[model samples]
Target: MNFLIRLLVTALAAMVTAYILPGVNIKDFTSALILALVLAILNLLVKPILVLLTLPATILTLGLFLLVINAVIILLAARLVKGFSVDGFFWALIFSVVLTVVSSIMHSIAGGNND
Candidate 1:
């Protein structure tokens, strides 16, 4: 139940991100939900391994490299999900940032935990 609420909030955030970010395109509610689910799964499963693998670079970059890794993950999600598209590399980066911000705000407003 909590997870379902979080997922719905995430999907809403994705839809909002798509509305605000020109480069990010989510065709419909279903696409937005799918994209949000995929993104959450990727962040949960793949991002930790990626963070560990790039720990040195992340340290060297003073944690800034995490942004690049996030962008890459968002690009991967966009590629994996149909009807959810990011225009280009630059767009993917911007969309990633927007998505993160929107999701964070939504989660906080909904009293969801970061965990």
Candidate 2:
């Protein structure tokens, strides 16, 4: 299905990103898949609330505060997922940015519908 393909693409992106970033580690492809799922869940359930609560700061920072929120999500996933870890907040931020870029590229290459 489309969802499965997207998940695979995301997992590949996460694995590639983790391999590129020294401070981020994913134990294996399975861990990358789990990481992708956790990130999707967090983005669906938590991101909206976070964006709502941080509206003022987000507005003040010209929407850049979303980057911090993305880092927080990564840190949270690191804690929740057994084989995935980010060294610290700084690493989390870097990992998040890199992951986004990698994911976008992978999705585009995969012809994933922009869902």
Candidate 3:
């Protein structure tokens, strides 16, 4: 299913982040899967509301403030998912970018939906 594929892609991305970023830590693929699931749920249910609330700062920063929001989300996910942790907001921001790049590649390979 598409959801499963997305989760796998996310897990893969998490692994890559851990490998490439020193401050990021993902225990294993299973933990990565759980982290991915938690992140997906948060992004689905929480991210929009956060974006709405931070719209003024986002606009003022020309959208860069969204990165901070993303780091916050990552920190929240880290707290929820054991064995997957980011050392600080600095690492979270880097991990966010790395995850985005890796997931984009995986999604393309899986023919993911843009919608």
lDDT of 1 by residue, 19-77 (tens): 99888899999998898789889999999999999999999999999999988998999
Which residue segments of model 2 deviate by more than 4 Å? none
Location of the lowest summed lDDT over 10 successive residues in candidate 3: 106-115
> In candidate 2, what are the lDDT values of residues 1-115, reduced to their tens digit?
9888878988999999999999999999999999999999999999999999999999999999999999999999999999999999999999989988988898888888766
Estimate the lDDT of model 2: 0.93
Candidate 3 C-alpha lDDT tens digits along 1-115 = 8788889989998898799999999998999999999999999999999999999999999999999989999999999999998899999998898899988988898889987
Candidate 3 local accuracy as lDDT?
0.92
- lDDT winner among the candidates? 2
How many residue pairs clash per model? 0, 0, 0
- lDDT (C-alpha, whole model) for all candidates: 0.88, 0.93, 0.92
The C-alpha TM-scores of every prediction are 0.91, 0.96, 0.94
Candidate numbers, best TM-score first, in rank order: 2, 3, 1
Worst 10 residues of 1 by lDDT: 106-115
Model 1 whole-model lDDT (C-alpha atoms): 0.88
By lDDT, the better pick of 1 and 2 is 2
